[model samples]
Every structure is written in structure tokens, then in C-alpha cells.
Target: MLGRFRRKQGANTQTGVQEQDIGVSNSVEQQGEKPALHVHMPGFNHNGHKVTRGIKPDGESGRGGIHPWHFIRICFRSTSHISMIVNVLWPFVPAAIVIHFARPDLHLWNFILNYIAMVPTANLVGFAGQELARKLPKVFGILLETFLGGIVEIVLFMVLLHNDVNNNLVPVIRAAILGSILANLLLCLGFCFFAGGLLREEQEFDEVISEVGHGLLLMAGFGLLIPTAFYASLRGSIDDALLESKTLNISRITSVILLVAFFIYVYFQMRTHHGLYDSVLEKDEERDRDRHEDLKKAKLTLTECVFALALALTCVSLHAVFLVEEIDYIVTKRGVPDAFMGLILVPLVEKAAEHLTAVDEAWDNQMNFALAHILGATIQTALFNSSLVVIVGWGLDKAMDLNFEVFNIVILIMSIIVVGNFLRDQKSNYLEGSLCILIYVLIAIASWYYPNPAAGTSNTAEGAGTKAGG
Candidate 1:
């Protein structure tokens, strides 16, 4: 009896180990490994049960678990792959439909011609930075873009300022400033912050970007202060002849002086914040140390570069010329006020498409590059574009002394304040986005209802323009 019990115990121990490996039920082991109680997991069976090979248990997934990050990356890649189609179709289809149905006197052909000429030049100026960035290191790329963009804007404005169209310098300058400011604040910054939030768990901008933002905020503050000073001077009866055409030459001289001083200040401040040689030095060092000598041969083909440049130029030129006309017409003829157009419609129209670029960059984890592009673009729009418009307006027959209607004044002030707050914090949230959108709306409303220049109203921008031109 003892020998028999020993043998049975050994057999039972072997069966239990085999059952565990095959995932057999406990009931089967208890029933002495009966065939009827056996369940197979492909090529393995308990007791005398027949198990077929290549058969998995019900509800067992063949695919392994995927990482959350991997899934998200895949989704982003997929979305980007199809983005171009949507971009081209979304704007054109709707516009074509509208034109077909509305049948307005605005001939698409003339609009196209004006758009092609004006907008492309602006784009070319913008693309100068991109070209610089691609050829040089990132930091210098930004500075190059900013400075060159300013030069391009100035040149173009000079050309247009002397043009024989409506020949109203003031409106052209005002429109340019309006377009530039709106583009920077609403589209560029807004999209950057939004995309950053969505793509990154917690996005953090680099020190360089932070410094740039700070500089922008300071400039905005100075811009506001300039207007305040003008108002005070005018109210106090400083110079009755100061604003007259007789003093136009003197005004231009003053404008040049003030502008030069402001530029010098900005230059010193930038150099202090960001060491001048860092970006260039780093690029040189990297090139020197590179192990793969063959990689130096690799560059984007000239043809490809030219095509991209052309496309960008075409789009921008349209934006600069025809888009402005459309916007002006819509506001003047169709009851959309300047402020509303500047604050809302302009931003939405100009930026909505551009936001796609940021989103794509963010989704790919190129946070620094994307953010830099966005911020740089904004700065260019503000400092470069707006300044050029005024200078150019001066050249066009007479000084387009832009008077920021009270609504524009409020909008500009609120924009500076909100953007400054946003940058100072630099930790964007949904709440901040809501606040920004709300501010945009409020300014738009105020601009629409606000009266134009009243008797004895001050011309803030013109005063500054005069000071700068002088």
C-alpha cells in the first residue's frame, strides 16, 4: 500500500505542473485528469483530450499592447499625411461656391491679379528668414529673418507709397499695421500656444524665445507710451504748426531720429540678453566636429527651394494686396468695421491655414523650432511690417499720418496687455485661451460701434511717425 501511494503522488505532482503550464482547469486535476474535463490551448492538452495546433482560446488577442505615445504618434503622422488636401480644398471650394452663387461685381480675375502682385512680395520678405534659417543655424536664422523681413517690407512700402492707385497713404499704412498686428497676436501666438498644449504634456519654451517675447512686450509698452505722450503734447498746445504739411519734412526728420534711437535700444538689449556669437559659433563647431564628411554634400535641391519660395511668395503677395482690398471692401462696403476686420476676420482668414504648419511641427515634437517660427513671424509682422507701412505711406505722395481711431487705440492697448501677460506667464492653459479669445471679441465689438476721429482728436501714430521720420 505504501509503494502504490508513493507512485500515485509522483504521478499527481507531474500532472499538476503540466496542467499549470497548459492553463488547465483545477476541476480537471481534481477529477484525476479526466479527458472530458480537459481544455486545450493550441497543441497542448490535459489528460487524453485531443488539442488542435494553431488554435487560440476565445477572446485572446493576437496583437500585443501598444504604448500610448506610440498610438498618439501614429495618429499625428496619419493626420499630417492628409492635411494638404484639406488645406487646398477647404478655402478654394467654399470661395468658388460663394462666388458662383453670390455673383458679385468683384471679378475674380482682377482680384487674382492684384493678389498675385502684392501678396507674393510680402511672402518673399517672410521667406527670406526661412532661407536664412535653412542655410544658417537656428538663432541667427531668426535674427536674419527679422532684419531682412524689415528691409523687404521697407523697400516694398517705398515702392507702393509712390504708386498712383487710390493714392491714399493713410489707409494703406493703417491697413498694413492692422494686418501685421492682427496676424502676430491672433494667429501666430494663438496657434503656437494651442498646438503646444495639445502635442506636449507640458511645453516649455527656450530662454532665447523667452527673451524675444520679453523684448516684444517692452516694445508694445513703449508703443502705447508714445501715443500717450502725443496726446499730452497736442492737448497742451505744444506746436500748432507741428502737424501741418509745412512741417512735413521736419516731421519726417523727427520720425527718423526717434526710430533710430528705439532701434539702438533694442539692439543693445538683444545683444545683452542673447550673446551675439553663440549661434554662429555653435554651427561652426558642429560642422568642424562632424564625423560623416559625406553628409555635407546633402542639401535641398535648388529647384525644390525655388518652388517653395515661389509658392510662398505667391500666397503672401495675394495676402498683402488682394486680401487687403477684399477686407477693406468687405468692411467699407459690406458693413464690417476696421476693428472687427483687424481683430477677428483678418486673424481668422490669414492665420487659420498657417496654424496647420505649427500643429504639424508640434505633433512631431519639434517644439523649439515651431515656437521660434511662430514667435519670430509675429515679431516680424509687428516691428517690420507695421514700420514699413508707415515709412512707405510717407513716400507715396504724402505722409499717411495714421490716426488710430479710439477703437484701434483700445484694441492695441488690450492686445499688448493680454499678450504681455500671456508671455510673462508662458504657461498657457485653456483659461488663458478663453480670455484671449474674449479680449479679441470685445475689441472687435468696440471697434465696430466706436465713432471715427472727432474734432480736435489726437493723431498718435502720425506723431510718432513724424518723430521717427525726422
Candidate 2:
């Protein structure tokens, strides 16, 4: 519904002007544009009268128009209520500090405080990323935004790797990777559609976004499948020792391949095929203009953006360390299922800010932006963050691989298919969103009962490494 006709009042009219306006309107129509109507988008309605005034054929002023949000400011602030709440959670950071040293036995409390504290820092990182993104050209900005958005997830993964003294966290890390993807695909996107549907009966976005996201996800899923299948097939033919070695080698190769595919995707997205995304970007611009935040310029300066990002990265890294350290205690001592802890709890905390942003974008009728954010982040979790963990594991010699449990991979592939089908028409409603969430709930329930395998016997590289080392 974006760019629909909505006539504005106060335009000059005079004798003989009608004929001139008619000619201009016809010319505008021939140019494939509506004759200078006030911008109208889906989910909102306004009574408009036909106007005789001349509107630029470009349909806008220079680079659209700049609203107050585009004004250069010295400070950075997020107007989102979620961001405010995340900001309020900042006190938990210091609380985590005190509890870690003062009362070290309270592992559960330490975990809660640290993860809660992480919310604020991750929000800050996203804000800084967004602010900095607005400073660059549209293409690079989108790429940068996606990269920085996943920084928290990446950092947490590395922290888990660094702290996995017994290989216990490796399974959880693998689960978290799949969990993050599910979170974005089902949870975040579900809320986006549900929220957007609350405003508009049905909303539509560019199919290209869906195609790209789904294609890449399928590719990543295939990468996951190959390694799992290899492990399964060879686990029978070969002895346990040889099978383990082959699995790790295959997983490492898959990681490199996925990374290569991701890089090629970046080029395809930002270079030769950049034109494919202009529709999304244009719609995003129209959405901002509708909200009177026509930010063709940035709200923060280079110095403020850099400083904010630095502080955010440090805080997120620090709190992530705190959170990872307590996982063992909760899983082993507290009897919380590691599968549930990884697949359900971890993603909720890690992607809190992103979920909020998606919902916000949907509420504002920016379905394109919302969908792009969701799909882009999910793709990042698959190709970038997940691969980094394997390669990082390779360097550390700590036995990490793409050998996710067969059950988990099946769930992942099915979820991807479900999401891809929903996106087939490039239209969304609350009902579709609800279904996605329902499936996620089912997955969570299943995970709640999922067994926490013994440290060395879990379905990961640890078993193989242990066998060989022994």
C-alpha cells in the first residue's frame, strides 16, 4: 500500500490551471507514477481529495526528505521501550560481578543476572551498529548492520568454546546455533507477522528477500546434513575410532565450504545483484518517511558511534563470559536439561534486542525492514557464526563439528521448509505467525525432556577425540 494516492490540501488553483494539471498528471501516469499524492501505506487510512498541484516526477524531494531523526546529534538514544527495559537491566551487570566473587555458590542466580545484564549490552551494540550503518552508503550499511548484529552471538559462542574444559558446552553450542536460527525464523518472524497483522489485515514484502534467505538457509542446512549423514553412514562401516576422525574432517571441510558460500553470497547481495534489494530499501525509506524519520543522514557522529560500539562490545563480551561460566553448574547440578537450556533459554537472551526490533518494525508497517532483519540475522547465524565455531574449534583442537544430533537436524530442516513455504507468497498474517510460534513451543517442550548426555559420550566430536586420545 506504500505510495498510494492521498491528496493534500492547500494547493494553488486558478483559471486555466486545470488543463495544465491534466497534462502533467497524464505525463506522470505515463512515467509510471501516481500524480503527487501524499504517501499512504498499508494498515493506515486517510481521506484524501484529488490535488491539482505539481509534484516532482521523482515523487519526492532530494533523496526523499530529511526528518528530525536524520539530524546530526551528539548523543545516541533508542526510543524503543524494549531498549529502555534493556537499559534498565544494566544494574544486573554489576550484580553479577558481586555475586560471582561474593557468593560463588549461587550459580543459577549468577546465570540469571549475567544473561539479563547481557541484554543491555547487546542492545547497545545493535544501537551503535544501526547508528553507524546510517552513516554509510546503503549497501555497505546493510552488510555492516548484519555483521555487527551477530557480534553478541559470535562472542558468546567463542566464550563457550573457551570455557568448555570438559566438552560439555560443545553440544549446547551446537544446539544454540540451531536455536538462534529457529528463534529468528519462528519466534522473531512470528511476532513480526503477528504484530504487523494487528495493524494491517495482510502485509506483503519482496519475494527476493524470501528467496535469498531461504536459498542460503537450505544451503547451510545441506551443509549440516552432509556432515551428519557422513557420521551416520560411516559409524556402521568403520570402527568407532576411524569414524570419529572422518566426521571431524568432514565437518571442518563443510565449515570452509559454508564460509565460501557465505562470501559469495555477500558479493551477490552487494555487488552484481545489488539491484535485487532496492525494492526492500525503497520501501524502508518510504516507511521512515511515513514515520517522519526520513533519515537519509545519520543521527550520530563517527566518534560517538565508535565509542558506543566499543563500550557495547566490551560489556557484551564481559557478560557473555559470566553467563557461559555458569552453564555447567545449572546443567549438571541443577538438573536443567542442557538441550532446553541451549535451544530455548540461550536464544531468548541472545536475540532479545533483535526480536524487539522485528516486532517494532512490523508494528510500524515496515514489513520489509522487519523481514529483512529477521532473515538476514538467521542467515548470519547459519553461515557466519556457526562456521566460526567449527573453525575456531579446529584451531583450539577441542573437537567441535557439525555433528548435531540427528533429531535436531531433522527439526531444523523441517522448520526451514515450513518457513520457506509460508514465505512462498511473500505475504504474511497473524495466523501464519501464530503457527510458527506454536511449532517453536513444541520444539521447546521436546527439548525440555531431551537427555543431557554424559560429558564424553554426548553426540559431538568429544567422543571421538576422547577415543583417539585414550
Candidate 3:
């Protein structure tokens, strides 16, 4: 709302003009060999105002009109918060419209894979921004990076969606998930330390922000666990039989009761630790304040940011739909379920795009935010996105359960193992990243074969339930 108008005061107008005038004055003073005395310039009346001639655009006494730098400075100086909002939100309009149209065509697999691709594009934009930052003044460089990075992400998502995707998307999903995690944990964090070492030892991390990240990670893990346990149960005939009998009965009400209980437990736990939570909130506020100050110093308004964000989201939605269709096509040819395709193939393909942002962010001194992005994305996909799939499925004609079958259990276990390792260390090297990639590859390979006799079960019903929980 504040970004809707231009500034009328023109308080910052003199700055750009002053810079030009000073530079010109210095250059002229240095041109002649003699020490020099000041001289006056000729004046003329123009447009109801007196015009000084021979001053050039440098804002000198006898200079010409406004210089290019001065003009740019004025634009920056004059724009108000209202104009900023327009700048930022305007780009998002196209993005939102695209997403709105494309949502029907997208499958879960496609969305995840496309998200992976977006990461890389974002990183690349970040890197380009870093380069620009080095070349330009800090304010312009950072703004350029933010603006371009946002645009790049949206563009990539749109491109990915423009195609039809189907089949074997599981690999892509899995690969992308790993890519996001590895880039954030290993690439972003590692590079931050490496590059940060080049500067001063006084550098500190945003602990409050880091705590939020930790919370996100924990939530993602728990969300995945639901699907994991459900899938594991399906492989166990005894457990599957019991659950099936109980779950199939509308009058039984056991599932609902359990869910309610679980909700209560979670609520109470949160209530108990609310103070600790408030500490995290306080820290977040501090970080936000600091960020705000930095942004203002850099002469960037939030509206430009909003515009870029909206555009990116739109492209991402479109690309996500395309990716889903392509995966479905590929999977049908390969004769695999859409879920498996999402779990495997889609992620692998999407990795190239996802890392772009991470790479770019690493180039900047913005590792903390980059880390947040990776972890936050993962959490959103695992929890919020997955949850929405289930809720929406319920609203649809069919009761779509997202139960994991036996194969999904393996994936879950593997995910748990890797995530645990990742969190335990909190510091990742290139080797760790490679290991994650290797783990994903192994899982992909293993998913292609038939299950053992002990593991064999009807894949659909249980798979649906587990997938939903996941």
C-alpha cells in the first residue's frame, strides 16, 4: 500500500545533480596547467526560467542539461513506496494468471520437479547479481541481482511447464529434492564459510533465522514420516489387514479419533514451548529490521521485489504443469504410476534448474537466506504441498489416499537416514553433496525392480494413503 505513489518532496533530488557538478568542476580544475581563478558563465532565459549556458550536463554554473547519472539519481530519489508496490506487484500479475490457468494440468510430480529447476535458475541469477555488485555500487548491484534473480526463476519455471511431461517422474522428484537439500546444506553453507573466511572473523550467522530453518526441517521430516509409516504398514500384511478393516468402516471412527488426538498432542506441545517460540519470533524481527535497513541503504523498494516474486510464481506454475504432463507421458510409456514418476525421474531432471539460485546466492553474502530457501522449499513441498494434495483429493470425486507402498517405505527410510546425517553435521562438504546424489541414484535404481515376495502388495490403495500422508 505504501508503494503506490511517487515522492513529491524531491528531498533526494540534489544529490545526483551535486555529484555531476562536482565531477565536472574537478575535471576542469585539473585540465589547465595554471592554478586558476573562478570565472562566471553566460545565462539565458528559457521556458520562463533563467538557463545558465556552457555548464554542460554536469550541473555546473555554465554546464548543459542534466547528466545521465543525475537523471538516474533523480528517478531513484523521486520514487515513493506506492510506486514501489506497483513495480513489484505488477510483474506478479502475469505470473499469478499463468498459475491460475495452468493449475488444472499440473500433477504433484511436475510441480516438485519444476521447483527443483527453479532453484538453479535462482542461483545463477544470484551469481550474476554478485558480479554486478562487485562492478557497481552496492545499492544498485544488490537491487539488480534481486530483480533479475526473481525474473530468472519465474522464466525457468515457465519454460519447464511449456512442455508435456509424463512417466518416471519419481526419479526427477527424488533427484530434485536431493539437489535442493545438497545445494543448500553443502554448496551454500560451504561456500559461505569459504568466501566468508576471505574477509573478517567477525562475521556472524543469523541464529534466529537459523532456528526457523531448523523448525522447518523438523516439520518436513515429520510430514514425510506419516507416509513412511503408512507405507511400511502396507508391506506388513498383519498391520495392513488391521488398518484396512478399520479404515474402510465409516462407523469405526478410529482414524478420526487418532488424528484428533495427534492434533491435540501437537497443540499442547506447542503451547508448552510457546515462550521458546517467542524467542525465535523476536530474533526473526531483529533480522527483518536489519534486512530492512540494508535494503533502504541499497536504495531498493519492496514493490520491485513483489513484482519479481509474482512473475516467478506464475512461470513456476506453468512449468510445473508442463512437467507433470511430460512425466505422465513418459511414465505411461514406461508403465509406472504417476506417483513413482514424481518420486524418481522428475527430480533428476529438475536439478539443473534448482541449483541455479543456490549458486547465485552463494556468490553473494546471502548464505543464510539461501539456506532458508532450500530448507523452506523442502518443508513447503513435504508438508504444505503434500497436505494440500490430500485435502484437495478429499474434495474431489474420489477419496484419494496418499499411502506409500513398500517401495515408498524404502525411499522414506533413505530420506530419513540422509536428512538425519545432514542435520547431525550441519556442515557439509562437497563430498557430502556427492554422497546425497549417490543415495538418490541408488534409490532410483532400486525402485525400478519388482518387490520381494515378503514386500509384495497391491500398490494402489496403500500407496495412495501413504503418499497422502507424505
Assess each prediction's global lDDT (C-alpha) against the native. 0.46, 0.76, 0.40
Best by lDDT: 2
Q: Write model 2 residue lDDT over 1-470, tens digit each, in one string.
A: 33332222213344348779889899999999988866633231121222112321221222223333442232234636566556767778788878888988888898988878888778877877776675465666767877888988999899989987656577788889999999999999999889888878998888778888899999999988888888766665667667777888998998898889889988988888887686677766686524554332224445566777888889889888878888877776777776787788888888877787778878888788787789889888899888899999999997788888777888999999999999999999999999999999999999998876543353544342211122
lDDT of 3 by residue, 1-470 (tens): 34433343343466768788778778877996444567654343222223334321112212223355533342233222322222232334344335545673444434444445444333333433333333342323333444443344233223332331221222233323333343334443444444433433323444543555556555554544454365445555566656644333321232233344334533432455445544543343354423443333322112333333354445544554544555544544445543344444444333332344443333344544444445544443444334433343334423323343445544554564555555454443444445555665665566555331121244333323222122
Rank candidates, lDDT, best first. 2, 1, 3
Instruction: Give me candidate 3's TM-score against the actual structure.
Output: 0.46
Rank the models by TM-score, top first.
2, 1, 3
- Measured on C-alpha atoms, candidate 1 has an lDDT of 0.46
Give each model a TM-score. 0.58, 0.81, 0.46
Q: Global lDDT for candidate 2?
A: 0.76
Each candidate: RMSD:
19.2, 9.4, 17.0
Model 1 lDDT tens row, 385-450:
554455555765455443444445555656766676776654564345446656655656665674
lDDT, model 3, position 374 = 51
